[model samples]
Target chain A: MNAPAAQSVSPAPQQGGRPSPPALRFDNVTLGYDRHPAVHHLHLDIAPGSLTAIVGPNGAGKSTLLKAAAGLIRPLDGVIQRGVPARRIAYLPQAAALDNSFPLTVYDLVAMGLWERCGLFGRIGQRHAPRIAEALRAVGLTGLERRPIGALSGGQLQRALFARLLLQDAALILLDEPFNALDAATVADLTALIHRWRDEGRTVLAALHDLELVRASFPQTLLLARELIACGPTDVVLTDANLARARRMSEAPDPHAAPCVRAA
Target chain B: MHAIYAWLIGPFVEFDFLRRALVGALALSLSGAPVGVFLMLRRMSLTGDAMAHAILPGAAIGYLLYGLSLPAMTFGGLAAGFVVALLAGAVARLTQLREDASMAAFYLLSLALGVTIVSLRGSNVDLLHVLFGSVLALDDATLILLGAVAVITLFSLAALWRPLVVECVDPGFLRSVSRAGAPTHLIFLVLLVLNLVAGFHALGTLLAVGVIVLPAVSARFWARQVTGMAGVAIIVAALSGWLGLALSYHHGLPAGPAIILVAGGIYVLSLLLGRVGGLVWRALPGRHLEA
Candidate 1:
């Protein structure tokens, strides 16, 4: 990795969006597991309200970096500071490892988002009810508020969690593989929600494995393989050389975008 | 008629012993339900069991020192459980071994150590109280101590309720909000040890866990949410305690085992009767035709 492509380094993205005081900024972020560095010397400012992606191959530390940003894991070295004062951040984990035996309803599941605001001893106020209802409706689960999460199909379960994200009323959302194990329709539905969030001046950072989805949805990309390969506007970052290096450093190149090259 | 009256309704009106037992049972459930819920979630009820057995040695030593004071024995036991859990947590975090493996090691070592201490320091009567418990011997001071412990456990749970449930359900989300759950988990462990120690005289180590676990487990069959489950567990626990104590008083059977057996019975019934998915519930009509 070299300039125009930094090695063991991360740089400002070429979004022309005026860095925008990044809703999230990674200043020389060196991340990993057990003190073994995974993503190195990474620096990127996610433009406020922009839907930026940390895209990469299996061992590329895609999940690792996202986990770091979510504060689930502290970086081996470096800081991840949220823009603005401490804000409401929503995180949708890699499909909940929830005990299926738990037997919670979709309404109950979505309403959990209010836990931060409502506090435990108090009841969910009448004011919060409409938000819960609106969230379910937004996720196309209008009448299914009472549906047991344990009984939901994979897609429905995904949307229910989406409803939770909606109810969180958070400015920053970090989704880890939210699209995994979903059908095409579910993906389309979630993509629409992502689009809505980006349009609303809310910051969205999603870690995705699908290159085509990343290309279509996000303007800025953070390509990685334990080090940032390239991060900028899709056109600049998705170049053939970058894709090839990404592919070579990565496991398999999607032939759909085979050349991944746009002619001049 | 007298026997029937005593067995059926003696708990509410008759002996002060019945009042104490009833109150004791209610307190036990209040403390135990939340503890059981977390243990089941963390998959660390076995650690709770380890603490229970570990407390026996401290309890035995406390008795040797102070001659069978509930406060002395229970406080010593709680101290012992707390130390063991902290050491286990520390070992798990610092060493290559994971939490479950470290807890297992702590458990076996504690149980062995407890047996040694009891054999070395305890007399026959002390041995009986240490292992089997003395639920029949209800003193006013002991009841008050148990009641106070239950109140603190309930209030702490109420104050820390949502965070604890959220932590168990989704540590990732909780962590994302910058609330790492290790400390929260330690707090839960301490509460569990206190409940185990508090309920020790009412039900012995093995039997107390049964009383604590069974109601919460049984209640899950009826609840779709954490709050609902907890509420149901409290109700079932109190009911079983009152009824079992009354039955024991009437028949002169051991009160601890009687209460535990009632809880166990509820669990078995719940297992047979639980309805998890819509498939089983919806199958009732269609299956009737098929049959």
Candidate 2:
């Protein structure tokens, strides 16, 4: 399958040189469900147009952080300042987050990427068709437009989701475990798309499990173990000492920990 | 040829009550069936059934307040349904119980309370009428109410269609992108309660949900998209109403149960023969597609 160039899809308009602010700033943010803090004492600043990998052990709150950035959850304490509007943000949660059993065609699902532009009642005119078709073509899903999403293979579904993301033309993209259970080829194709988005100057944050892929592709990395372990160049953050500390901190979670109260 | 006419068309043509009943059933089918399809898609079919029962107390209160007044009972039923829905949701959020469990508890109480309230003032005949419904007794006022409900339900469904679909498919995504998710959900609940209130007038509280749910579930076998499923559901529901009413005319059977039973039969047939994922289609191993 060919990896069609995404330039024909909505290209991000060129912005001339200007002092860039942090794409996101997490100020002492604490996020969890039901007062149980999955992420605590986190302070980080993400530069504009940076492709960062958030790596952590199981239960280390990678998904939680992305969700907070997407404004899906409120911070239990402190603040997270997102530089983009909700419409300018595109979030691709885990595959399990979507109801794959829903009866939707690939074309229709991809068309949803036009939501920010068309809105609830806006018509999808003749002009919009080519954009949707180009998105599908970019992700190698051109011929499968009519197929029901339930009939799609895992790889094809992920590709279709990527097509939707491509159409989003978002300034900031948050991906939560996007490549789990996918073939190597699918991963490669998707990674290429991510690179294209980065080239077009979009801030991309991905919660990833694959250290090798992160090392090769992601320039910056944030290692988390319920708290900020390290954030720097991928090589520096993924060091032996930092990895061991992350694993140790994430291993034991107190079931009966007292209600957290931290003074600034 | 005349026998066909006598069997199928004669009863509807001859009796004014039969014609009214047919129109009432068709209205329910048009509006209620699509709502059922959404309920089924959301896996809230039983919840819809529970909600149908939850309106009993409200209608009963109306019946108690004004003797068989349509407007009173309709308002009471609507208020009651909304109260129960909100109560169940609150209970689920505040306490350890899930929404379904709380809904179940509320509906049972509502049903019993409604029945007691009705028997407090009315006779066994009236109790039967409230429980089993009186399709043959539908008046012009009731007919107009049914038509209006159909129009409102369809228009609301169309207006909220996109957000509703996004909410169903990926709620977290919807929440992230737009605020339409929660408001759209609230409006959908209103539609559900409204349809149930309208349905109860024709089919009674106990059996109103049957017309709503049966056609929606059956539609799953035939269509693989929301629009297709709703279309199939409307057709199946309308057909069931016609056949069920015809059966009542010829066999001296009760009308509500007869209609539901015909819908049940269609559900079974769709289960066997439907093209998308029906039993027979699944059972037969078809040729694999070329990649």
Candidate 3:
């Protein structure tokens, strides 16, 4: 299929309508597990208020890259610098990563987003009630606050998770497959919330599988297959040639098989 | 009415030992029941059991060295339990062995060593008292120890409540937001060891876990929230202690095992007839959702 023409998307204004610096920068970074590199030699900058989609075939290290950005996993080599503190970065892992057996209510789960401010000892006072309500309303989960999270359907649970992200009110949001297994209506609602976040001058990096959605909504894209295949405007990065290259590279075996050299 | 009063209140009113046993059991239940609730929630019920057994060797060693000294035995049991937990955690992290398997192995080794040590010096009667406890013979020092442990456990649990809940629900999320994740987990382990140590003084290593775990599991069938479950567990534990003490006084049975058996009976009853998630509820034709 033919790739769409490149579209120029402007960055949203910061608070007081001022321009902001880059939200994140990766300088020669390598991320891995058990000393086997998953994202290798990455050099990139994610500008503040930019909505970027990361897409590629399976084993593309998309989740690994996001984890590194969130500081959940340290870089094996080089550095990943963030403009904001770790608490100001919100990460929503895949739905399956959460333990549903926990006997937490939707309200209890959503209120955890305030943990950065309230901490372990602090109580959720009346002052924070409005924000929690607003977040739940944004995600269309208002009436289900008292319901147990385990009782929620998949779509409702996704909505509740989004409500939690809303309450986090972070400057940088990283979502890994937020739309997976969600219904079309839920996807549309969440996609709208993402756009609203971008418009509010928050940086959002989503690892997505839907190329059509990326092309339609996201202005920038990072295509990867263990290594950076292409990074630029969505139209330029999602080209037929780049996609084919990513697929081939992902399927091929490493020719130089050797023990990983630890960084000094 | 007089017959009922005689069955319930006469044992405590007539005998100081029965009164002491009741107080000790209630104190243990107040703290240990909540810990047990968290244990069941975290799926660490078996770990609690193993830790109880692991304390035996240290207590036995203390018995050998000091001859039934309460302080020595308490210290030894706490040390041994902590050591086993640390070793099990380290082994799980450093090696390919799963946590459950490592804990099981360590606990079995500890139990065997404990029994061997106890058999080396103490008479069979001493061994029986050590293994099954002498709740009816609680001294002033033991009563004071149980009371102190309950107070400390309640305060610490209150302070650590939020972090502990966050860790249990979503550890990765907790780690992402704050640096307290590891400390929270460590505090929880320490609390578990503390409760186990407290429990050993009243019910012995073999039966202490029953006092903690049975009431907690029984509460699970009746309550949907953690706080409610803890409350129910405390009630069940306290009730079992009261009834068991009365039964022991009337029939002259061993107090510790009698208490545990009462808790076990409640657990079985709750499993069948509780209002929250009981077997009876599941068997109902129209029931759909879990409480």
Q: Which candidate's DockQ is highest?
A: 3
Task: Itemize residue pairs with steric clashes in candidate 3.
Answer: none
Name the regions of candidate 1 deviating beyond 4 angstroms. A1-19, A78-81, A119-123, A250-264, B1-4, B10-14, B178-180, B274-291
**TM-score against native, each model:** 0.87, 0.94, 0.94
Off by over 4 Å in 2: A1-18, A255-263, B289-291
Ranking by TM-score: 3, 2, 1
Q: In TM-score terms, which candidate is top?
A: 3
Q: Name the regions of candidate 3 deviating beyond 4 angstroms.
A: A1-20, A251-256, A259-264, B287-291
lDDT of 2 by residue, B1-291 (tens): 999899999999999999999999999999999999999988899999899989988989999999899999999999999999999989999999999999999999999999999999999998888888888899999999999999999999999888888888878767777888868878998999999998999989888999999999999999888999999999999999999999998999999899999999999999999997788989996998896
lDDT of every predicted structure (CA atoms)? 0.75, 0.89, 0.87
Classified by CAPRI criteria, candidate 1 counts as acceptable
Cα lDDT, model 1, residue A202: 82
Q: Report, to 2 decimal places, the DockQ of model 2.
A: 0.57
Lowest summed lDDT across 10 adjacent residues in model 1 chain B is found at B276-285
For candidate 2, give the lDDT of residue B258.
95
Cα error, residue A70 of model 1, in Å, equals 2.4
Q: Specify the CAPRI tier of model 2.
A: medium
Error of 3 at B11 (Å): 1.1
